[model samples]
Target chain A: MKNKSIELMKRYRFFAIMIVVTLAILVVKPDMGVRVYSLAFNSVFEMLGVLPPIFILIGLLDVWVKKETMVKYMGKDSGIIGVLLGFFLGSAAAGPLYGAFPVAGVFLNKGSRLANVFIIVGAWASMKIPLLLFEVAAMGWQFTLIRLVMDIFGVLVIAYSMEKILNDDDERQIYELARKMSQ
Target chain B: MIMTIIFYGLAVIGLVFSFVKSREKTKMALMKALKAFENILPQFLGIVLLIGVILSILSPQQISQLIGENSGWVGVVIATVIGSITLIPGFLAFPLAAALLENGAGYMQIGAFVSSLMMVGIVTMPVEVLYFGKKATLLRNGMGLVFSILVAMVIGGIMS
Candidate 1:
């Protein structure tokens, strides 16, 4: 019961705050507040519409991405090759920053080191390789290429720096999870 | 029915392959949902509100005058810088850039601006910091800003 309440609160805090803020705004200026909320909500819903296809792709990957691949290629000590492996995997992985975070957490759980996970998640947030292909088609090849190159370089710089800076904070559960998975 | 059938077929293939391989079901489901929600929905809304507000506030004419004045190279620089700062959504960035292009804005400027919009974003800095740490986010974003401008210039030179 205690856990349930905490979970509910965690999930609904943004929703609750939004509602309260809207109410406060409405009290201050009724018509304008409704207008703004309506606009914001409409925008949010439109964003939500892009969810399904991405989800389907994720479903496909759940069956595909492997532990050995991650370990051999994207492992912490595996230098440039590992970095390339991380960059490729991350760029290929679909989604925005939020989507990448939970996956990174999972990677940590799966015995993937903090650094590789950082690189991968960073790429996921910043790099959109597949989307760039469409962008080039609609907008021009040069434009897309420039942006893609910039993004790749940026991700590399950030990922490398992060590999230097961040302390390993993962709990002992990494080995535990690795053991369970192998079993 | 065909689409649904295909979906089920794919799902069955995926699920069967996983289950037979002894993969974890709950982890897989949660993972799928999380990735999807993270990518598409966020960009969609994030783009719409950001572009909507900017367009609502600043007219195309205003934008053209401020950053669209020069077709040679100056406009490209200004547009790229502004776009980098503003952080427009990906899907929406193109259509809007297209409009700006049609209305006397240079393609290179549009290109650069659109490029920079995604690459260099101040609004997302907080979240980036949270995930990647403060120093890396700042340095990377700083690098991104420089790279985005250079990208705009090169694309501008190529087109113009």
Candidate 2:
């Protein structure tokens, strides 16, 4: 029991330190404390709201989507189709970039091409379809359209660039890490 | 709100279909989901708190003041730096950027901020590293940072 508790503490050490720091801020500056507390509370709520469905979908995808199917669609030789699918999957996703990481890990585990996975991350980070509405509303169509085009281009460039940069050993290590994490 | 509904709806449909197909696999999926969530929970909590601290210190008003219309390349640099370090949600970030624009912040600066905010995540690097190793994480963020600068220049050129 003690060992388990210690392990838990180690896992949560950063969070613990943050709590201490927040408390210290609260004591030192009550106004900043209140702002931080509310901001943190809102983010916590947002995180909870967005995370459940994503994790559940990821789990379902892991079970239902066969590795062969994933590879066929997104593997090294999947080509243009894989690229389009990666962008589609990512643009369709709803959540923050952090939420995309686990899904990316699952993609790697499922034999997805490295470039495809990077495309997904890039799309998730910037080109989400739903958020595009928000962007257009706030930034105007001209600004939004330009940024959208640039972002799509940037995603492709970054994805392929990373793919080219990483050696065979790096790719294997990434895949291995994903497999271990997903398991 | 609509997105949330769509997500939950899809998840429910998936769960129902999986359960109908095989109860054992459904159970396994739930277990995997739970385990994955647990694994990342610590990092998530830490990131949330870190964001809270960063946002509180650098409020939207301060951000606008720092990146005014004539702030030029220096402002873009500062904007990208702030965006890279902080993890602001899109909902808040968009409105904040719009407000910054209204408050005389340059297009280049806002472009840099938005692009970097989406692409580069210094605060969430721990979680990213857990999934993608240090080398890949660093390289991706480096690319993202460089790309954000490019994005800023393009927006500045055409828009301004």
Candidate 3:
């Protein structure tokens, strides 16, 4: 029991330290500290609102989507279809970029091409469909359209470049890492 | 709002379908989801706190001042740096960007900020490194930073 508690503490060490820092800020700067509290509250609320469904979807994908099916669509020779699927899956996703990492890890674990996984990450980061609507509303269609076009190309270029730059050994290690993470 | 509803709607539909297919598998999926959520809880808490600190320190007025129209390429660099470091959600970030634009921040600077805010994540690097390893994480974020700058330049050229 004691060992388990210690391990849990070790896992949460970063969070513990941050709490201390936030408390110190509250003590030293009351006004800013109040702002921090409210902001943190809002962030937590947002996170809660977005994360549950995302994780549920991920869990469903993991359970229902067979490895062979994933591989068939997104694996080594899946090619442009894989790329398009990556983009579609990513754009359709809701929540922050961090949420995409676990999904990408699952993709890699299921034998997705490295470039395809990168495409998912890239699209999730910059090309989320829902966020695009928000961007259009706030930044106008001209700015939104221009950035969207550029991002489509940018995501593709970055995905392919990252795949090309990593050697075979690095690729093996990444796949190994993903396997560990998903498990 | 609509997005949130869509997400929940899809998840609920998926859960119902999965449950009808196999209660055991549905239970297993929920367990896996809980486990994954718990696994990342510590990092998520830390990120939330960090964002609180950063956002509190950098108000919209202050951000706009740093990246105003007259701030030039220097503003773009600052915006990129800030964007790379901070991890604001899209909902908050877009309105903030819009407000900054209204406050005389340049299109280029806003573009840099928005792009990097989405793509490059210095604050979330720890979480990223766990999944991607150190080298891949660094390379991905580095590429994202470069791409964000390119995005800014093009937006600046065309929009302004």
Which of 1 and 3 is the better model by lDDT? 3
Q: Candidate 1 residues A29-74, lDDT tens each?
A: 7866666556666555443443343354445454466767666665
> Over the stretch A17-91, how does candidate 3's per-residue lDDT look in tens digits?
889999999999999999998999988888777789988887888899999999999999898899999999989
RMSD (Cα, Å) of candidate 3? 1.4
Candidate 1 vs. true structure, TM-score: 0.64
What's the ranking of the predictions by lDDT, best on top? 2, 3, 1
In the order shown, the chain A TM-scores of the predictions are: 0.66, 0.94, 0.92
If ranked by TM-score, best first, what sequence of candidates would result? 2, 3, 1
Highest-scoring model, TM-score:
2
Model 3 steric clash pairs: none
Which whole-number lDDT from 0 to 100 does residue A54 have in model 1? 38
Top-scoring candidate (DockQ): 2
Q: Answer with 2 or 3, whichever has the higher TM-score.
A: 2
Interface RMSD of each: 7.0, 0.9, 1.2
By DockQ: ranked, best first = 2, 3, 1
Question: Candidate 1 - CAPRI tier?
Answer: incorrect
Candidate 2 per-residue C-alpha lDDT over A1-183 given as tens digits, one digit per residue, 9 for 90 to 100:
999999899889999999999999999999999889888998888887778999999999999999999999999899999999999999998888999899999999999999999999999999999999999999989888888999999999999999999999988899988887787
